[model samples]
Target: MAKLIVENGGPLYGEVQISGAKNAVLPLMAATLLTEEKCVIDGVPDLADVKVMKGMLENFGATVVDDGNGLLEITASQIRTVNGDRKLVTEMRASTVAMGPLLARCGKVVMPLPGGCAIGKRPIDLHLKGFRALGATVIEDDENEQVIVTAGPKGLVGDAIYLDFPSVGATENILMASTMAAGTTIIENAAKEPEIVDLANQLNKMGAKIKGAGTDTIRVTGVERMGGSIHSVIPDRIETGTFMLAAAITRGEILVKNALPGHVRPIIAKLKECGVEVETVDDGIYVNARDKELIATNIKTLPYPGFPTDIQSPFMAFLTTVKGKSEVKETVFENRFMHVNELNRMGADITIENRIAYIPGGKTLHGAKVRATDLRAGAAMVLAGLAAEGKTEVSEIYHIERGYEKFVEKFTGLGALLTRVDED
Candidate 1:
């Protein structure tokens, strides 16, 4: 296990570079299975999840090479097997993404149930529904807890599919599966996140005809084949938002490089509402919180173009020292407030009722040993630790490493007194 030790009351005052979006790159990696040619991706983040995805691709007879300069070359000339490693597939929720391409390529796929953070029950029923709608037979092996998807002898035939909820994972799975289907596929109520748009753009580059990505409705016209192409991943909007809040929480000034300001407009508006100054600079965004007192603000997590659910935790951590009460409502994940208890341990006044959290600000937080429940929660703990009065130790840092690349290095570059400690 690894833990992070953070010293308190240091204002981060330097430039920090944002990495590629984990959510975007994962689906893009799975998309490589759609072609037999080499697919080269640039600006891919070096994270634990990326490494896991690389290993999974290798198991399926694909060659993935990292150039150590933010470039990944992938080629899936032939698929050696339809069965994936049970342990690896079960360890990452993104592993389920492979099922779509495998079914399209091999007419069948058998994989164990996917798993990741224990935030809540993220059922893949929507994904299975979309698969079934596309003329594939889905079977549940209850005894083994595995899902089996097989295409008929005629292969997949496209149809009109409507999702009960606009799940990002389901949308990605169905969209990828439809690329090589027999006919046109219309997806209603699809996810409109920027990551979804990025995936659609990449698929288009690979010769798949996809349109209306950043909207509720998506249309995919199936092609006979797809070819690989070079593409660059988008910057991590969630990481950018986290750094912006880190500045506000510690009364710091930071310039976030390679940031897409339009993607984080909601967060920037919220920070400005809390009395933080944000400006758009060339190729980056600069945030200043020096000599500023944060004010409590109400926030509600929604889909893109609204406040992002991934950033709610770190934003909540910043609100702890505000002079008034703040209300935070989480509309995405059910168990996202798992960090409330951990934050309370650090002398924060927070009470959660159902999906809503009421935070009475102005509490002076002191250092305490806290465990990171999930990825975003781990970020919240780090932000709280940066503003607390004493030294704080954050355990279970593997969750943090799954998404963020060079987390400690980036924070240290921004003048944060944080270090990683190995516990054997």
Candidate 2:
């Protein structure tokens, strides 16, 4: 295992360039199974999850070539198997996305239950429901813990599908599958994340007729065949928000480049409400929190265009030093507050009752040995360590690498006293 050792009390400075979206790249890679031509994706981040997805695709007989830059040329000219690797699927929940494209191309797919973070129970029942609505027979082998999906004799016939919740993964899986259906498909209450819009844009470039992406309703007209297209992924909004919170937590100044300012409006609004100064520059955003006392503010995590649940943990780390009491309500994942115990261990005054976390601010945090319960929680621990007064060691950094690209290098570029150390 690798651990991160962070020295406290260093204010981040200088400029940091944000990477491409992890959420967008995974589905885009899976979408390659929808075509037999060569699809080139630029600006793909070099991360653990991306590598995992690439390996899974290779196992399915796709030829993936990396240009040593951020470009990936994926050619699925031949698919040898419809069965996904059980171990790989268990390593990443995103592997479930293969079901859509695999069923569309091969007419059948069999894979083990996907796994990733231990945050909460994220059921794939919604995905199965969407598939069933699109004329696919979905069966679960409870004894073997596997899922098998097969299209009917007439193949996939598009129909109306409604989501009980705006689950991002479910929406993506259905949307991709519907693109190759026989008729039009309607997805109600779809996820409105920017990454969804990015995926839709790429699919359209590949000759898919998809409308109303980034809206409550999405309509997809099935196409006989999709040609290859070159597309650059959108910048990572979560990574951008992490850097912005890093600036505020360290009371530093940082200019974040290659970030979409409009994508993180809710986060910026909350930062301004907490006495942090944020301004939009020509191609990036500038953040300054120097010499300012942060005020406590209440935050509730919701769907896109609302406060993101992904940013909730990092924001909680910042709230520890605020002037008053602050409340964080997590509406997305039930077990997301696992970081609260770890944060409290570092001297943060926090209490959790049900889904709400009460943080009494103005408390000075000290360095402590902490385990990163998940990806976002690891980031929160790093933020807390940056603002603390001693050495902080964060273990289980593989979770962090699953999302962020060059995390330590980026933070170090911003003048953070952080380093990666190997632990045995």
Candidate 3:
């Protein structure tokens, strides 16, 4: 176990380098499985989940080499097994992403239900539905707690699939599976996240034809085979949002480098709404919260181009240091409000009813022993600790480390005093 000890670090004043998108890199790692040649990936963040994916790929007999500096060389020349490791599959939710590539390449994939953060009941039904539409068979073995997917005799044949909701994972899974299908596959009501566009771009580089990636609809044409290619992942927008909130909470100035301004437009807009100064420059996103009167703001979590659900908790923490009241409605996940109690532990005045969080700002928050109930929640705790009156001991920091790379180092670079230490 690990814990982060944080103190009121005062106003931060420096630059922080944003890491590669953990979400984008995970799906991109899965994309490497679609080909047998060598694929080089750059800007890969050093995270636990990435290590798990690398191990999962190695489990399939793929040779993955770390060339340092966020560079990875992966070659899935031969797959030894179709059965996804039961232990590894249950460890991380993104493990399910390998199903599409395995099914397309090996014609069969067996994996247990994927496990991830307890944010919501993010069911794999959409993914299975898309798989079945692409001429694959899906069977749920409740006794063993695993899903078995197998391709037909003629393999996957593309078909028009419509998603009830724009699920990001479902969109990527279906898009990857349909790449080698016999015909054209059209996905309507697809997730329009920038990560999806990154996947489409990478797939297109690997000889897959995909269009309309950053929109509600996406089209993919089947090809005979796919070859490996070198690609660099986009910067992490969720991390970018967290850093922006860090600046706001501490009343500081931070120039977040390697950040994609377009990817975090919602956050930038919301910060400007709260009277915080945010600017987009040729290099990266710059946030100045020094001596500004940050105010309360109502926010509702939605998909891309909207306020992201992942950054909601961190923003809520920032609001606590402001003056007035704010409302946050979470429609994406039912259990995301778990962080509210932890925040309240730090002298925060927050109440929840019917998935709506009522937060009255201007509270003098004092640090306390808080547990990181989840990833983003952990980040919120860190931000809260930075602005709190006293020392804060944040437990269960593994969740934070799983997503954000060099988290403490980056914060410390900005003069935010926090340290990660091993706990006995």
Candidate 4:
């Protein structure tokens, strides 16, 4: 196991280059099954999640060549299998994305339930429902935790589908399947995340008709086949948000490069409300927060174009040092307050009931032994520690490293006294 030994109370100031979106890259890798030609993806983050997705695709008989310089060249032109290895599929939630492409291309697939951060529950019912609506049959083997889908003979036929919620995974599944279906498919209440838009752009490059991806309603016209092309994944906005929050918590200035400023409009606004100085340039975001007094701000987690749920934990970490009381409402997930207890261990005063969390700021915090309960929660701990009084030992750092590339390096570059160690 790895632990982060963080000596707190030091101001962090520097520039960080944001990586590709993990949320975008995973599904984009899965979308490769829509074509049999070569696809080269740029801005792909060197993350564990991306590695797992590569393993899943390799299991399906695709040739994956990581160019050793942050570029992945994948070709499924002669894919020899539709089913992925059960063990590999169960390790990453994004593996479920393979279902759409596999079924759309080979007509059948056998895969295990995907796994990832232990933050909340993910129901694949919507994913299965959309597949069924597109004329695919989904069967689950609970004993083995496998989802078996078969689409063939007559081929998939597109139809109008309505999702109860704007599930990102379900939206991706439908978008990929509809590309090869017989008729036009309209998906209502679809997810409007930048990742969804990135997937749509990639599919469009491969000859798929998809419109209005970053909106509530999406339209997809099924085509016979997709041709391969090269597309670059967008920079990871969540990573940018996390780093930007880190800079704020430490009362430091940081310029995060390669991140689109528009992608983080809501977060930038929230930070500005909290008295953090933000400047947007052509290629990056510069955060300046030399003032020690941080104003408390209320935040509510929502879908894309709004405050994202993925960055809530890290945002909460920033709120810990603000003056006065702050309120946070989580609408996306029920059990998202798992990080509250860990923060409390470090001398934070926080209360949670139902979907709302009340945080009273302006407390001096000292380091304590803390554990990470989820991916983003792990990031929250790192931010909290960077501003704490003394040494903070953050356990379960593997979770943080899984999502953030060179997290410690990023902090060290900013003159923070942080180190990674293999201590129990």
Candidate 5:
């Protein structure tokens, strides 16, 4: 086990470059399975989940090479099977993304139920519903926890389908599978995230006709085959948000490079409401929280163009030091408030009622031992540690390392005195 030992309440001041979107890279890696040629992907973040996905692709016969500087060159030209290693697939939730490419290339795919952070129950019913609409026979073996799918009539004939919600994973899965289908497919209520648009751009470059990607409705025209090419993923908005909150919590100044200010508009608006100064330049965002007392603000986690659920926990940490009261309602997942208990350990005045958390701010927090319940929650703890008055020991630092790149180094660069200690 690993623990983060933080000396609290240090002003963060530096310029940090953001990495590529973790969410974007996972789906893009799955896209490599669409063709048998070499596909080079740039701006890939080094994370545990990425490593798991790479291992999964390698096990399924794809040759992968990483340049260690956010670039990956993958070739799936000689795939041996559509079935992925059950153990590897079960280790990461994004493993389910391979369903589309495998089904498109091999006409059959067998993968175990994917695994990820223990935030909430992320159902795959929407993904299955979309595949079934594309003429695929889906079978679920709950006894062994596997989803085995085989091609249906004419090998995945595309059709119109509607989603109850704009699920990001479902949208990407359907888009990839429909590329090789016989006809055009229209998806309504699709997720409009930048990552989805990145996927559409990559697919279109590979000869897939996808329009209206950054909107709720998307259209994909099937092609007989897809060819490979080089693609670059956009910067991670979630990582940008975390750093934005880091600046606010410590009353510091930070210039986050390569962050798309438009992608984080909702968060930016809320930050302005909380008395943080924000400025958007050509390729970076400058945040200054000096001499500002953060005010309480309410947040509701929705899909893209709205506040992201992944950043909610870190926002909660910011609220811990603010003056007045705030309410956070999480609509995306039922159990997303897992971080509340951990935050409370750090002397946070937070109360959870179902999915709603009411926080009264202006509390002088003295850090204590805390455990990270999930990935984002782990980040929340780090933020809280930076603003606390005393030492903070956060366990399960792996969750934090899984998403953020060189987290300790970034915080340290921003004047945070923290150490990653190996615990016995």
Candidate 6:
């Protein structure tokens, strides 16, 4: 197993180039199944999740060529099967996104339920619901934990579908599936994430009629087939927010390059409230907080255009060092507070009542052995380690590698003292 060893480093100060959005690029790779022609995706991060998605695509006979840097040219000229890989499905949650593209391209798909970080319970009922609305028969094998979806005899016909919640995965899956359906499909209460808009743009370039992305209601008019197109993914807002927290936690300065200021408005607003100086430049966001007296602020996690839940853990780590009392309510995931105990192990005073984390700030945290409970939780541990007093060891770092690209290099560039080591 691999573990991260972190030591108390003084304030990090430097510019770090942000990687591509892991959340956006995964679905775009799945979208490659829509066309037989080659499609090129630029700005893709080299992540474990990306590699899993790449392996899944290749599992279905798609020719994927990664340019080592950040370019992936995929050609799905022939789909060998409609059956999703059971092993791949359990490795990453985004593997389920392949269901929509495979079903749309082949009219049949059998996939196991996806599994990612165990932060909370995320169900794929919405994805199946959207597919069923599009004239597909969905059968769930609870015994084997698999889902089988097959289009009707005449293929999929578009229909109006409403989601109970604006699930990003469901929205992308349904959007990709609807692109090649027979008629118009209206999805109400769809996800308004930038990744959804990115996928919509790529789908449009491939002759898909999609409008109202980045909104609650999306309309998709089906086409006979989708062609290939080249598209660049947007910068990772969650990653940008994480790096911003890094600057705040260590009282350092960082200019996060390739960050879209608009995508991280909530994070910037919250950071500013904590007495961190943030400036959005023409191409990047600069954060500086040396010797600043930080205050505690209440935070609530919500959907997009609101405070992102993905950054809740790491931001809470920052709050541990601030003065006064701070409260964080996580309305997104039930078990996201799993990191609270790990943070407490680091000598921080934190309590959870009714699932809300209450932190009394100004508590000195000494470095201690911790674990990366999940993807974002793993990052929170690293951030806390940077601000702690001694050496902190974080185990189960594979969770961090799934999302963050060049994790050690980026932090090292920003003057953080951390290294990856093997634990036997």
Candidate 3 regions exceeding 4 Å error are: none
For all predicted structures, in order, the TM-scores are: 0.99, 0.99, 0.99, 0.98, 0.98, 0.99
Give lDDT tens digits, candidate 3, residues 284-318. Answer: 98899999988999999998878999999999999
Stretches of candidate 1 above 4 Å error?
none
- Per-model C-alpha lDDT, please? 0.92, 0.94, 0.93, 0.88, 0.90, 0.94
Which should have the higher lDDT, number 2 or number 5? Answer: 2
Candidate 4 on 211-290: residue-level lDDT in tens? 99999999999899998879898999999999899889989988999989888999999999998999998779999889
Backbone N/Cα/C clashes per model: 0, 0, 0, 1, 0, 0
Across 1-424, the per-residue lDDT of candidate 6 in tens digits comes to: 9999999879999998888899999999999998999999999998999999999999998999988989999999999988888888899999999999999989999998889999888999999999999999999999998999999998899999999989999999999999999989999999998999999998999889999999999999999989989999999998999999999999999999999999999999999999999998987999999989899999999989889999999999999999989999999889999999999998887999987999999878899999999999999999999999999999999999999999999999888999999979
State the lDDT of candidate 1 residue by residue for 1-424, as single tens digits. Answer: 9999988847889889999999999999999998899999999999999998998999998999999988999999998887888888877899988988888777899989988988888899999999899899999998998999998778999999999889899999999999999999999989899999999999999999999999999999999999999999999999999999889999999999999999999999999998999999997999999998779999999877789999999999999988899999999889899999999999997999879999999988889999989999999999999999999999999999999999999998888889999999
Look at candidate 3 and tell me the lDDT of residue 354. Answer: 96
* Per-residue lDDT over 86-197 for candidate 2, one digit per residue giving the tens place of the 0 to 100 score: 8899999999988998888888999899999998999999999999999999989889999999999988999999999999999999998999899999999999999899
The list of candidate 2 runs beyond 4 A from truth reads: none
What's model 5's lDDT at 254? 95
Q: Which residues of candidate 4, in runs, are more than 4 Å off?
A: none
Q: Write the per-residue lDDT of candidate 5 for residues 77-116, one digit (tens) a residue.
A: 8778777788887678889999988898788899889888
Error of 3 at 69 (Å): 1.5
Model 6 gets an lDDT of 0.94
CA-only RMSD, every prediction = 0.9, 0.7, 0.7, 1.2, 1.0, 0.8
In model 1, pairs of residues that clash are none
